[model samples]
Target: MSGKRSIFEEVGETTPRREAPQGGMIDKGRGRARSAIRLWLMVLFALVALMIAVGGLTRLTDSGLSITEWKPLTGALPPLTTADWEAEFALYQAIPEFQVQNSWMQLEDFKAIYWWEWGHRQLGRVIGLVWAVGFLAFLALRKIPAGWTGRLVFIGALGGVQGAVGWWMVSSGLTGTMTDVASYRLATHLGLAFVILGFIAWYIFLLGREERELMQARRGKEAKLFGLATGWLHFAFLQILIGALVAGIDAGRSYTDWPLMGGQVLPPSIWLADLGWRNFFENPGLVQFIHRITGYLLLAFGIMVWMRGRRSANSATGAAFTAAFVALCGQVVLGIATVLYGAPWQVAIVHQVLAVLLWVLILRARFLSLYPLPQSIRRA
Candidate 1:
């Protein structure tokens, strides 16, 4: 039996209170490498962005078909000796791109284009290696957070598929009269690239904070706003694919006019009787027309999403959507400039890079909508 103690006396010794657990409350159950994983993803993000820029340059310079062969392991090392280069050049000379389009290219000229394609492939290999090493190390050490292993592996699987699709795209031009990869194939390749980038970006956002915080924040998610952003993202993706078609066929330079095509509501030769529906992808005027109209529609929808985003109680979420809309506006300006200037490599690459920026921005906005972060009433 225990004697009763005064209200504030040493009753603590008589009856023990359950103490809270030690260690970090926020990261209690999460893995220790959350920050490390985030850093790795950011590195991949930069590499992929660089890959896109280099790829755009390769296309603009008409250098994509230079290598004329796919050698995943052997191709990693570019030609080291003159004899090796000569053998490589011989292979390129046999392709339709060299025969019909670049027949005048000497060995030195071939070297220029070869370097671009080789560099693109090498960068891809480096990305694959980096991903493999980081992922395996995390998984082996059990450093990956619970429920994240499959998501990480999914990224690697997509990377492998991208490699195979890339080869398929290259093979299309090797035997045919086509000087460039088929336009639809190019669109597919580009669409997949953006998809990969989106996944990396979404994962990065999720990893920025601890798992507990994300769950807490999810309770306050703005559902309607999220729905709007989802629609906006899908619309933007469609526009991107259409834009790829325009680039694939050099349609951007076909008209070089805005608000009208060939000084008319529609391009004079907008339809190809023989190609029929294929005209949408193969015909330059029709493709650009669709790209422009899609741009207008995307902008309009973005504005609607942004307006709804304004109602979010969370300041950070609203700000993210505002940033996305600003990017969309700037991208429109760049698009107009790209057409006005005939899609020069300088302006065109910038346009392409801006598209990447806008894409990330939209994704960030979407993430914030799904995980509304509470903010201080006063500035921090």
Candidate 2:
């Protein structure tokens, strides 16, 4: 009996029994919560995109300069009485946009533009309330996973900053020197919004891989591929910034011809202004030409990245690459059409929407590449 017991003990020592708990109901519950948060974040991102599109329409319609005041709180409510409309119109009449550009504009004309500006402000308010409520709910329920609380806080802070930046952009036009907000400030405001969107997408990816089994399965070569995908996602963001600059300067309004501007591969003179560097941003013609050249360069880079992704063994990567390729082509076409159509409000809005969608796809690809679906989930 002692000999048999010794043999059993030896066998037990040789085959190590893992005491670590297999993630069960608790993990599933956590996963469900994480998934819910991810879906919520995605919805929030879509709302943000809608806001951006509407803002672009506001700019294109010259409606940005229609409302001269920035009442952060009460401004959410639009004019409900004739007295209110008169007051709003009176305030707009004081600005240079009214004095110089729209002096002949009537109260009815003012209302046409006022509604767009008001709608934009109201959207900002809605976004703020949604973010605050969602964040608080997560904290109250202890649904946010460990290490993610800090990130959520950062996102909240960004939301605040974005509100401030929107006001800053509006303030630029209020001073009367320029009919529109400074293009540089506009780019900064848009760029920060994109950053917030990208961060939320990344957080979702992290939450989806909450299980140890999923994490282990995703380790190694798959992880490295995800890192590469993230790099491409960042590249797409920079391109969007450049696109914003193009919009801010009214750069797209200048050059209409595709593949050539005024029958030349390049603008006849790269820099026409006395100040060489200033020409890039201030000169609409030069700015448009530069934007076009940059677009082509970005297309080339995106194609290369997509091709490399196709060579990867991961099907997720292959799918991402294909989507990127298709999106880039569609975006390029929309961009050219926008320029040729003279930046019409409807076309311009669609162009901006497509850009946002492309950004979302790039972000999704990066997330999937970083964390491949676990074999069990993939099969399911």
Candidate 3:
């Protein structure tokens, strides 16, 4: 035999070297992009949370009506000169809030409140810009997942609506004998903020898992528990809105005593002679009474949900509900304490912050219920 070696002696010719299954390439890219988006959303989430806190402070300090004009784009720039400051103050002076409630304020005092409103609006602009930049960067890079483009865009839409809603709430106070924005309008604004926050948080939870994982997890979803958790979530949301209504009318300060309001289970008057349905919104007594009853109902509902959560085979899911229940308990305590203390800014802000915490915890619990993670045998 001639000593000619085969050229393919050292090479592997198995199956003609398939091109690594091109179908999964897109999915891999999508997974990575989804992760990046999730991180960006977390940043937005934190910013929204901070915005809520700042808004609470603005409300508590009676600084909400400091700016009389909407001026969304142009108002971004604050007063840069004494003349500018005077112009801004003059605008505020024309508002009913200044004419009726804050009449004793001078330019310096006006500046104090003006800064709060400006900072609140400025933070909103920053949130909007962050969302836009991140969403556009992903789109430019073609990194957004197949179904996520609309969701990302929706966040921006909601933010735009929120901005308009903010202006509407502000405009409510600028006319006629109104010293503050209507309580219903204030509730609407805060309700939308929490709604946006909820959606962002839920998207984050969904993106935390891979598509395959989420699909597989769906097979084992705890349907009944999910339903219960969902109900609890709705209940909690209602309570938050009621709390907003309470804050809008300074009702928390009205009922300083918790177990009893005004030395009785019910306050003396819940209605005024001329006003009929308006009293429910404008009357501090009725609003606070409604808030108190809703809080109690919320606690009972939380306990029920917690009992159901205890039965979850998945330890992580069970623990999430437990945490939510615990937060609810803490929030109730904070509410009572805030009331006992006449809703001072410090204590009241803490109360509002606890409401935020409770909200996120409930959302987390519900998400976990929807997509329960597998538990380790040892941990189980």
Best by lDDT: 3
lDDT per residue, candidate 2, 1-380, as tens digits? 54456633545457877788655544655776788788878777777888888888888888887777778898878889999999999999888788878999999999999998889888888888888888899999989876778888898899889989988987888774677787878888888888887787667666666656446655624665566667767777777777777788788877778778878877776677686777766677777876777778778877877877676666766687679779989998998899888888788889888877788778777666656554423331
- Quick one: how many clashes does candidate 3 have? 0
Provide the RMSD of all predictions against the true structure, rounded to 1 decimal: 2.7, 4.4, 3.9
lDDT of residue 326 for candidate 3? 97
lDDT of each: 0.88, 0.78, 0.89
TM-score of 1: 0.94
Better of 1 and 2 by lDDT: 1
Clashes of each: 0, 0, 0
Q: Write the per-residue lDDT of candidate 3 for residues 169-284, one digit (tens) a residue.
A: 98898899989888888899999999999999999998998877787787778899999999998998888888888999998888788699999898877767777888888888
Question: TM-score: which candidate is best?
Answer: 1
Error of 2 at 129 (Å): 0.6
In order of TM-score, best first, we have 1, 3, 2
- Minimum summed lDDT over a 10-residue window in model 3 is located at 18-27
lDDT ranking, best first: 3, 1, 2
